[model samples]
Target: MIRALLDPSEGEPVQIERAGGRSPVILVCEHASRTIPASLSNLGVKPDTLTSHAAWDIGALATAQKISQLLDAPLVHQRFSRLVYDCNRPPEAPDAIPEMSEIHAIPGNRNLSGEARQQRVAEIYEPFRQALAALVAARTGPSRQPVIVTIHSYTRVYFGAARHRAIGLLHDRDRRLADTMLQQAEEHGITNAMRNYPYGPDDGVTHTLRLHAVQNGLLNVMIEYCSDLIDTEKGQDEWAALTTRLLEAALERFDIHAAGSQQA
Candidate 1:
């Protein structure tokens, strides 16, 4: 969906997309893509940096969009580069709106005054969050909401390094959705699933899951796939079909652990 950002396009670097879904299961991709406006070309980062994890998940947007299509799920995503500001981080954290990320140095973010940070918080961050919170609040109320599934893709390696070969199923204090989804993945013979790979709910991951899931008390999990795994249409469709199967199945059997535990 096209959104409004009060800050000038200079510091304003973010986008959000949404699709309809029957379940309360909302998909969020905080570090979706890295496209710097012409005003600040490349964020002073090299081509390698753009390709690096510092920019965004290499092919996460494609996979996430595909999953959304397969499941007809609403996806709330950040359009700008994470180097500009991380939608997954709280505004208080320096990395919340990073000045430099790994190889890339964001000239726009550097020497940013308080007004500048607040400008981004008000413009890009707040709008994206408000959109998501509104979605959850609407889906849930006196009635039950569907599981909130945050979509993410991580590199097989970090900083030109290789990591363990497994897709991570991430969650924080809330595990019902992750547990159910993990069980379904394993049952399908997907043996390489990582309980929490790359990073967990901790390690400064804020915004998306914390705001849309944990704080809201929605059944939620952050699902990640290896970059190489879903880079191709064949691979993308593979994940889409398999994940949709697991999500549909788990959601069907879901007891709304968040609601029922207290309801009883």
Candidate 2:
């Protein structure tokens, strides 16, 4: 039998916020937490490395929470480090459990048996994926289909290259939400928004969009904020407010009610 990957003291693999909200928006922060379950021993990584962007998307959960509060949307987020299993990536993808993230080589994930791999997938990825799927399923029907809005954060500099785009609205084949948001970015005070910059569909970053949203024929977009821009509470709030406005305008274009339905 494969050993348990998470201790009882460690939290569940996924967390759902604002589950009872009435909005048709479903927010997801797959890389929300930097926590590595106690069983992994921090994946043999340095303490600082465990806290870096490799472990989680800095400030993304906070921003998503704010958006959830403002829009009264339900949010589903992963609760473990992505190094254990990137909830955004499917189980078949090798990088779902990356051995190397940027310059840091994950000693714990270097080589794994088949069972070990499946264990992570079952314990970490499935719960997060299922939670989001359930939310989408529950909100999907003839009267309303939930719009998936995934929140992510990217490093300001990667592999010694500087990234200047403050915001990235990413999409796969389905571009409805992204296109509208990009068209409304500047007017919403998001001056540095880019379409699929830093990473795009070809980069395999759209797995979550492809699996949960596109496959369900639901509208979706992956929103990426530069980590430096949202590392603090003030930044998270400001960006959340701006993103809330942008999403509101874009959703209004879709004929979805964008105001006065906010959670009290």
Candidate 3:
């Protein structure tokens, strides 16, 4: 029933959303939403679980929206349960089709045979990859060098564990973006911002950054918002503004301007 109800053609991919013309930049949110269709009642999830971190990034969707709006850049977001399949994950990872993400058991995804697994890869996963390829392909111009920016969020605590830290900016050796953003966040008085923790590009092994950024050797940066921070409307606005300022400032120093611009 769940499979039958899926509307892949409407651009309701295991991922979704794309906009703006060519730019030197691309924004991707891998854990944007947790919306399964009307069928299977969340593929057999309990009520509480459907709205939890296992499903979505908690605040990433709204944050991504704000960033896309502010930057006037295209954003591609994953639209289904990360449990059904994590678009950020490489095809071969064991947890690529996670039966359980953290504490939530995705009964619908458990123990599938090779054919079933491959079908999911074909039907849902492949379309997204192809669309991404198309996005990259479409981004050709005389002055543009495509830079991929991936948006994501993390739980404030690990397994309900506690941390005094408020936020983190996760990157790996991408000094151009990371240094600038880190400095901007600090100068902006975002006192609790950590340089990198919980996870970094090294930690998110099969992440979208690896798929597109590292593979293509483009400028890539991934930001992780702590869920508790952007879990509210006011919170979203504040962080979005913060992100925009820091990123724009950073890009300028790096001489990375959006393509299709007057400058470009």
Tens digits of per-residue lDDT for model 3, 36-124: 75543577777777888888888888987787676767788777767667787777878888888777888877777787677667755
Clashing pairs in 3: 24-259
For model 1, the local distance difference test gives 0.70
Which candidate model has the greater lDDT, 2 or 3? 2
Native-vs-model 3 lDDT?
Answer: 0.71
* lDDT values, one for every candidate: 0.70, 0.90, 0.71
Query: What local lDDT score does residue 246 receive in model 2, on the 0 to 100 scale?
Result: 90
**All candidates: CA RMSD in angstroms?**
5.5, 1.2, 3.0
Candidate ordering by TM-score (highest first): 2, 3, 1
List runs of model 3 lying over 4 Å from the truth.
1-11, 14-18, 21-23, 38-41, 172-175, 258-264
| TM-score versus the correct structure, for each prediction | 0.85, 0.97, 0.87
Model 1, range 109-174, lDDT digits (tens) per residue?
788778767766776677778887777787787776656777777777666788765578888888
Give the top-scoring candidate (TM-score): 2
True lDDT of residue 155, candidate 1: 74
| Reference-based lDDT, residue 139, model 1 | 75
Candidate 2 residue 122 Cα shift, in angstroms, is 0.6
